[model samples]
Target: MTVKDLATLTPSGYPAVSLLMPTHRTPPDNQQDPIRLRNLLTETRRRLEADESVPADVAAAVYDEIAEAAAHVDLRQVGEGLALFASPGQVHVRLLETPVHERVVVADTYEIRDVVADAARRHRYWALVLSEQPTRLWSGDGSTLVEVTTHGFPFTHEGPGGTQGLPRDYGQNPSAHRDERHRQFFRDIVTGLTQVDALDTRPVFVLGVERYLAFFSAEWTAAIAGTVPGNYDHSGPHDLHRILAPHLAAYQAFEQIAALEHLDVARGANRYAAGLPEVWQLARQGRGAHLLVEEDYHSAAWIHDDHLHPAEQQPTSAPAGTLVDDAVDDVVELVARQGGDVTFVGDGSLATDGRVALILRY
Candidate 1:
């Protein structure tokens, strides 16, 4: 699913089901995916049947929808994880580029905290390759970059310096005319980008030779990650990915360092929370500006009087207060939904601070 889906998805009816699991991309390991899916389907049926709240028809329909969605999964192209969200009228099957905690939830709302967290922490960007023949756009997740071939991509230059040559009437200024035509072509590419919903809010990396890059820079004035001088028109996804991977790695490293600096400044200004409970409270009250979480930290807790109480295990049924299967995930969802920054830092980066931290807006 896309970042837009995180906000747009809703339960068409109650008793929505979310199934999530880590998946393998290749080899003998991926063969177990079907078996694992069948087992989860069985678990889902059990949970729905056991629940007295959900009506029989609704339960059966949701299960069937999920099953249908599962049957269509292209195991050959499966990524690191798979997520299925289904209701009586809604269904979305997502192949996650990163692994998420394996879990299922049946509730009135879709389980999207994991998706939100991934979108918040994992970088998504566009790699725009410029050329006279045909420009291309690629969408990148944390680990993979896939070509975007619809609507705004594979833009071929068709005027002036392209297939058509300059008229003899403008021979003295033919170079200038050619440059302007290329600029206009690049402008069309930018306009085309507007039609692509998946390209929203993603930083761009424009790659081309010096002149083409200059024309593009002159036309598009948005969040460009960087410019790489290259001829990627002939390069396939694998070749382009090999060229772009190191750049993304460096960007991620820079982002982590920048976030740590933000936290330090917040702590110095007395606008930081050091642990989960305090962060949760601040986040609930909308005080969170930036949430910094350890990559491996997860906790299950109970909410009592709006405060979190540590739970020995994730509660199946809440007999005491309200059970939170994963408070860390909840907190991440809370901060991100309110337009706050969320970063999953390396483990032990905040060990003394209980493996979690928050930079408050105040």
Candidate 2:
């Protein structure tokens, strides 16, 4: 889930079940994903049913929705982790390339820490290949690109659509009719992105020839990330990734440079908090305006007495105060939930102890 979608989330109904588990991409290991998912669902079902605050119907709806989502979990399509969030009738499923620590939290709100941190570290976007025969949409994360099959993607030009659907005017000029049909087809794609898949949000990056791009641009109103004007219609995921890699790198490089500049300005104003603990405190207080973190920085920490301390191993059961598996992810979540920006820079960008720094909103 992107931070943009996280901002729209709120605690709803009774128990908000957040089920996350590590998934494997290859054989032997991947075979157990379905069973593991079922186990998590079973646990979530038990917790929801036991909670008296949750009405029976509401509990059932949540379980059914979660189960329905679970059924669609294709191990072949998944990356390293699968996260599912369910509250009453609402449900959200996300696949992550980074391995997620398995946890079953039945709380008032969805556990979004790992999701936030992953989204920050792994750049995700949409790669749309425009074609009249069959326009395609792909989900891109870092160097990988996967085709999207749901929400009526891979849309094709259905000329006249035959008697089953609507019939076009046969009297119109052939070229003009084809042009209108193409424009209308592109418009339908826009409608799907904004209307049909309204909740599924991402920065769209278009890949197409000049002709189709012009057609799509003319019909689409929403802002796109950038366009690569070429014929990638026949390109597979690997080839498409190779072509998009340079573009993605350029985009990220520009963003990283801009973020470093922002951090420098914040430092000059004495409005930044360096190191994890200091940033943690400010972030917890909703004072984080922006967080700049080194990409590989991670620290296991114990949080007690409103303070954070470095830990060698994460405490399994928190009899102490609380066991923060990765305080860096926690800090990212805290800042993001507070409407703050987060940027992951090169691993050595921050020379601080925790390799993290926060620009205080204060």
What TM-score fits each model?
0.85, 0.77
Tens-digit lDDT track for model 1 on 187-268? 9998877566344666677788998888887777666677889787898877877888878777767777889999999888
lDDT of 2 by residue, 1-362 (tens): 46756644665666788999999989999899888988988998898889898889888888898889989978787888888888876888887777898878888888887777777788778889998657888888776787887777878776653123444567767666667777888888877666533666666788999988998999888887788999888989889888888778777877889988998998899999999878898888999999999888888788877888778543455456676789999888888888888889988878853588888887
- Estimate every model's Cα lDDT from 0 to 1: 0.81, 0.81
Candidate 2 residue 28 Cα shift, in angstroms, is 2.1
* Sliding window of 10 residues with minimal summed lDDT for model 2: 159-168
